[model samples]
Target: MEIKEHIIQGVRIAELHSDNMLLGSVEEAVDLLGNMYYNQADAMVLYTEHIADAFFDLKTKVAGEILQKFSNYRMKLAIVGDFKQVSSKSLQDFIRESNKGRLIYFAETLEEALAQLVR
Candidate 1:
């Protein structure tokens, strides 16, 4: 995993570039955020390629559980990539609802994701 840290709008964002799946459960979310905190990053940004499929599968409940963990920690999370690839209406709705929030965002590109997170 290659973590690139950036300061945007006074927030420290850790962007992860990983060839393998990094998050799959609430436990993993904790571990991941622990790494971010160790790096002095306030938030995390993950690309679609780095995320596991379970995160997008509403039936798995991984998305809600993990995102809730992030919310509990008061840390921001952003998924940047091609969201159009997901065909589930429920998942799309979930993404849409999440985008309305300040903490979690689903964006098509890293730039747009950063923009939402910085705001």
Candidate 2:
């Protein structure tokens, strides 16, 4: 994985880029968090395509576990994706609720994700 740094208003945000699934389990999520924390990142932007498909399935609890770690660390996260194409109402609702807060957001573009992260 490659992390591209973005500093906005003195906040350091790490934008993750990967060719493979970067978050497949809780352990991987924690590992990612550790890496970001080590880099002194206040927030992160990730593309949905780089995350495991199971993360979008509410039954898997992957999203909850991963997001909770970010919340615990007071680190913001923004996921860039075409969420409108998702068929699961539960996942859609989850994304909707997440977007209503400052800690996490589901955005459609890199600009949108960065904007949300800086907010």
Model 1 regions more than 4 Å off: none
Candidate 2 lDDT tens digits, 54-104: 889999898999899889989899999998899999998999999999899
Candidate 1 backbone collisions, by pair: none
**Model 1 TM-score (2 dp):** 0.95
Superposing all C-alpha atoms, what RMSD in Å does each candidate have to the true structure?
1.0, 0.9
Each candidate: how many clashes? 0, 0
Model 2, global lDDT: 0.91
Q: Against the correct fold, how does model 2 do in TM-score?
A: 0.96
Tens digits of per-residue lDDT for model 1, 1-119: 99988898899999998878888778888999888888988888998777778888889998889998899988898898888877899999999999999899999988888888888
